[model samples]
Target: MKIWNEPYLETCCRAALHRLVLVGGGGRPDGLKDGPCLERLQGMGLARLRADGRYELTEAGRERHAGEILKLRKAG
Candidate 1:
């Protein structure tokens, strides 16, 4: 098995967050382990676990990506 690239965490986290917000949550990529994803996203200020296996967006985290999309939409 291969180790994950650090930058991929940001990208994956954004996609995962969007998926959660879009479809109301779902599964991870096959190779994306849950523990590390949670750790990475939490570190980046985008999410937190409520219970052992449950996660949700932090306010700063939600605004991080939401702010990005809002900027792009405004720019267009």
Candidate 2:
């Protein structure tokens, strides 16, 4: 049996994820120069391309941002 593991993002990729979240409402933000990092995030399903030719965070990405980036956790 194989166990699925969470993808590990490097510092650059994590920074890219943060940038996407900061953009919020969506529509490419200025100064987003991390193409490779964004591509890596896309491959991991953490971010996606918008119809307007911009990249945004997916639901999974938001959750990850909340948990990993913002360090927010659900109350147990």
Winner by TM-score: 2
Point out the worst 10-residue segment of candidate 2 by lDDT: 67-76
Tens-digit lDDT track for model 1 on 1-76? Answer: 9764434445555666665455334423333455565567777777766554566667866676576545656899
Q: What is candidate 2's lDDT per residue for 35-63, written digit by digit as tens?
A: 88887888889888776778889889998
Clashing pairs in 2: none
Question: Relative to the true structure, how large is the alpha-carbon lDDT of every model?
Answer: 0.59, 0.78
Q: In order, what is each prediction's RMSD in angstroms?
A: 8.8, 4.4
Show how many residue pairs clash in every candidate, following the order shown.
Answer: 0, 0
Off by over 4 Å in 2: 1-4, 29-32, 72-76
